[model samples]
Target chain A: MDFDIKRLGFTLLGLLIVLNWGLLMSSIMRKLGARVAKRYGIRWFQPWLDLVKNYALRSQISHGIMFYLGPVFRIGGGVGLFLFMPMIIGSELWLNYSFHGDLVLLMYFQFFGMLGMALGSGEGGHPYSAIGISRGLSQFTTIEVPMTLAIISLAIQYDTLSLIDIVKAQQGGFQNWTMWTNPVATIAGMFSLLGALSHSPFNLVKAPNEIPIGPPTEYHSTFLGVLQTNAAILHVVEAALFMNLFFGGATNWFEFILKTFFIYFWSVFVGVVFPRFRIEQSVAWFLKIPLVFGVLAIILYM
Target chain B: MSETKNNNKFENPHYAKREVTGPDGKQFIVDPIKDYFSDERPKVYEPNSIPVVEKFLNWARAESLWVLGFGTGCGSIEIPPLMTPRFDAFRFGIQSRPTPRQSNVFIISGYLAVKTLKRVIRSYEQMPSPKYVLALGSCTINGGMYFDSYNTINRLDHYIPVDVYVAGCMPRPEALLAAFNRLKELIKEGKGEKANEYAANFDWYKENQKKIIKDWNMPDYNW
Candidate 1:
């Protein structure tokens, strides 16, 4: 089947990079806030966290339409990825579009999910919701710069933007999945994962104690119910994306699920171990250190 | 007797004769004399539509009163317990609705903030017809805590028509219950004539609502 590479590229890019990555990152940061509060013997933050996690729990019937629509948009974006991402091990017949998967495409598509969430939050019309959106956007802005540099360096190293080509270029052994290819690139990848998950030391968007549930303060009823579901599913998507990019696509379906979940647990473990960062501190830290890793990788490639 | 026997035999097969029984364990023969005087006679099918009495009762039952949660001051804090597990005001057909569209009673809990007064007035206006304003806590009655302040509406009656005034800086829960009982009694007594009068004068109420909203520099309506 003849595939318009640009259209397919944009679609896949929109799904993985735009939609899933943004939500996965923000949700992890939000979950981290709840976890940290529980660990500190602070029960007061429970209601606050519940408020974020269950934004649509108590929504009025009049506003139910909007609340319900938010999650549909979110889940739809996630499902869109399954159709768009190219199958490496499976037959190409399953894919209507065949092209080398561009690393840049993956990065841009990651923001689609974030856009959906921000729009949903905006519709809820709560001050805290707006605040969360602003903070989340700020964090995205800070980390994305270094994340792009790292991806570009990987693309340059393989001399191709297609993710499939990048993985095929490293086909000799398991260590060839790019992380073990260079230590600096690996550190940059790990830090980028940290950024994508919005793990602690970078999770300023949904801070409970300060923001009173942040963007989800006013959401209730089915609206909140869907957001929780979106959060869980989006986690798997993020892990899958990370695994697909850094580790080669699995040879089998079982291995694919397993590898993605392993990455998810690793990300969660990192989230659990760290404390949160203030907006300025998060920006400063990601840019100064992890950014250096990306630069070094690029220089090494050159 | 021979003619009657012939008539019975000639009767149409389409007609079936039904036997009647009595509580006395005997078959009841239709004797005209006994049947004419029987109290167990079928009711005459006069248009026995819904009775006025029953209709009135049903209307009263369905006109379930709802209270608005427009608490103004310290007394506002006490409303949670009255609403929740301990008091459970929902049993009385009086549940709290945040907006006025569904509420009948605007229970002004206490001292109305200048800011809050504007909101209260708007809420009262937004409430559909047959609405009553209940000024709880003495602050709403005569501005108990803040009588001197020009910003405070000393007499709630001056701003919006109030039906009941419950006294105390913070009226005890019992006092609120008593006031609620009185409201129910007033409802039962059909003293809603005043509520109807206020609702009819929509322009005057709207003007007052606008004045409050304008004073606060908020829009006349949230929309």
Candidate 2:
């Protein structure tokens, strides 16, 4: 089979757009949080400035080679998810590299960054990094249970494992979307999305200003910049994936932006409203309500 | 100096050298300070050769000042308000980072006890180059009310090169914001080389620091 260079170029361009949109979305969400607290918040361009400053820092130190490869692997996971995901459904240029079994690959890509971070932060040797990694991995494991269940539900409903085909099935109108027809699975998926997003309630992984930050405690300069870059991409790509799954997939950039924003905002909204949960509390929480919803989703599909 | 009490009388067991069995049962000496820590001396990092690029970078650095969240003294009370609705320091691109490795601005808030000063020096050294120190409160200046107190040091600059001094018994958050602005101006004008200054005067700073921190068990540089 011949590789298509043109498709690769389009995907690269899509990645750039997704990255910028993710950064802007995060800034806007921060601004919203600030407004809620009756503060002016950070400037809209602050993230861009921070990225530049982090990259421009003069000195960089590493714990080991694994520490160096940590951020690389994380960005790899983010880019991999984007590569395999279909961004704008029904659009040839925005289809990315989505194929018959891309959903399974996307699920693997979702967890790839966390495992990479675990190795990297473990090498960092900061006690907090270890604590954070264990908390993150444990919470992530529970999160995956409900998320995987939801995906399995979708797979059974559609009778296909391909993300492109799933999106194709959901096309036509909003009523036809899985969110309406398969609300149970959508609910389970959205609940897990909160954990996936790692917002306020489930944000014990980083626990900034509490545990001296999490996995990236020892990361700085360019290494941190790479993590931030991946964060931006991962947020957008994950939102896009959800958009293609539950919400009707976007046919154009306008719908894509709107749907992705709302999907991303769902977590932010939940985050702003609730206080945080401790590691064990969050692990138990995922296993309880969301897990029940996940089981219910699968049973309904069956 | 009448016989100063030796704070180093007992070694910190954490930093003490000890033998440890590996996963495979082979024994090896584990000296925490020597084995775990980076012994590399701090080096002076110069700005970019191209004036334009350096100026641009300086602007970016100055615009996004990540202050270490470590609060040393009574003046720490003022820092919390900066994030409040009243001051809202985030609007100006000034934010607090939890770790030393990630932060460039270190606020020597109020008086520094000899015990705290040791940790301060460790944290200040751990921060990457192009860092700045904003000496807060009169306590950090001439020790303020703590001048006669044996516990706290009077002058902060002797241990760490300070860039901006925010004066007051306990400088209000407004004063801290003003200090931040002044720091930003200094950074943009290419005057924020305090990290390099510390490196150039590393021996002097370490000597001053060791004089106060009697139990100097950690490495010279925390990096």
Candidate 3:
């Protein structure tokens, strides 16, 4: 357990690169969506401007200390995921602090932000925050069932719990990737990714029209800017996790960007094609189709 | 002015004072107006002393005007078209936000009835400082056809500070876009300090609001 300052610096640098990439990818996706609807999209630099504007807001009101810590915990979760996730498979510098059993830790980090948001938004005392937390937690719980089942299938297939090892196992060729060798588990994992990403069809938690932007309804100013920052980092990190587990991790920055973009796009592609589901319908939908694939994945491994 | 009537019929019970038992079995008086809401007065935040920093922030603010999507009147129909392909206000960084806390621009579209004015005032106060109001339509200017009506207010600026006005019976989406551009120009010029103006004239604005609102169940300042 030797701690090195250089390693820490590289990890922080890696996080920065991922954050910028995430912002660019989001704006690009938004532009694509706008084009689809026959409308001009926001400028590519819009997200950066919004981030600045939110932080530049002169006034801020707080409900409690937890309200302040909410965004802190959320960004902590995003950073925690990055800390243990190996970005480029064969690169020693970008491997971060990933160790044996990091896969399990990554799973826990995925849900960490939501729980923190629940506590923070609950303290805000906005009724919509409560409704959103309930829906988000329930939907996220169901999403985890399929995702965890797929991971279990992968663990059984590779006989390891480390993401680095999992990525290593898939290296050499595309045929060796879990998407080919363990298609059932990949399907289950990919299906849950749509929910995990919280895009249109599964976006009831923050149903802007219905719930008035949900959990962060009361979050404003620098608080909201932090959430937006975490959102950018989290999206890319989540895609990176999937990239490592299923797509045979990247050996370089270019490969990393290309793979993560397509992985993130999978959910966005599904989102635009489908209409939203109610909380009940979404929870039930995840339990049915993705759950079945998850079970089938596990059974295949057994 | 006539004696202000206590409009008990319109008073919301949830906002009324009552006793509540906490989870620990402790009883406490709960006055929603005083206990649930922040009573702090809005303060005027002076611009940054450094010219470069202030100018940069103003530029960012101008480029990203998150409009509160609460349409007050008939001019609301004009807003939806701004999001459509024909207008597409997104390209100009004029996006709609669902909540007041996140938005800096409040569009007082069309005429403001006394009833909707209360909600508008609350939403306006809740917005963070350096906020701007884009009063749309002749309804907001002089009540348009509603000038003789018993309920609608003739001038919106009497109740809330308005930064830009788009004059029309109901301004078309193109006109609204022009108003947004004007608002952005004002913001970039560091002239969008109407939120501070409302704070400076707090008593006068509150008196004007209370004169028409009647019930006045909520606090003077919504924060």
TM-score list, all predictions = 0.49, 0.97, 0.97
Question: Can you give the DockQ of every candidate in the order shown?
Answer: 0.02, 0.80, 0.84
Give interface RMSD, per candidate.
14.9, 0.7, 0.6
Among all windows of 10 consecutive residues in model 1 chain A, the one with the lowest summed lDDT is A50-59
Candidate 2 per-residue lDDT, tens place, A1-302, comes to: 46889988999999999999999999999999999899999999999999999999988888999999999999999999998998887778788878634688899999999999999999999999999999999999999999999999999999988888888998887899999999999999999999999999999888776698999999999999999999999999999999988998899999999999999999999999999999989999999999999999999889
| lDDT per residue as tens, model 3, A1-302 | 78888988999899889989989999999888888889999999999999999999999999999999999999999999989999887778799989734688999999999999999999999999899899899999999999999999999999989889899999998999999999999999999999998998999888678789999999999999999999999999999999998999999999999999999998888888899999999999999999999999999999
Interface RMSD of 1: 14.9
Model 2 misplaced regions, further than 4 Å: B1-8
Stretches of candidate 3 above 4 Å error? B1-11, B21-25
| Quality class of the docking in candidate 2, CAPRI style | medium
Chain B TM-score (each prediction, in order): 0.64, 0.94, 0.93
Q: What is the fnat of candidate 1? A: 0.00
lDDT (tens digit, per residue) of candidate 1 on A1-302: 45567656654653444334434444444345445544222222222233232331111333345555656776665554444455444444323232544555556556666677777777766677788878877777767877777777877777777766665666666877776776677678778777776645565675544565566655443455456556655565666666666777666556665676567656667767877877778878888998898899889988
Q: Rank the models by DockQ, top first.
A: 3, 2, 1
Cα-based lDDT at residue A73, candidate 3: 91
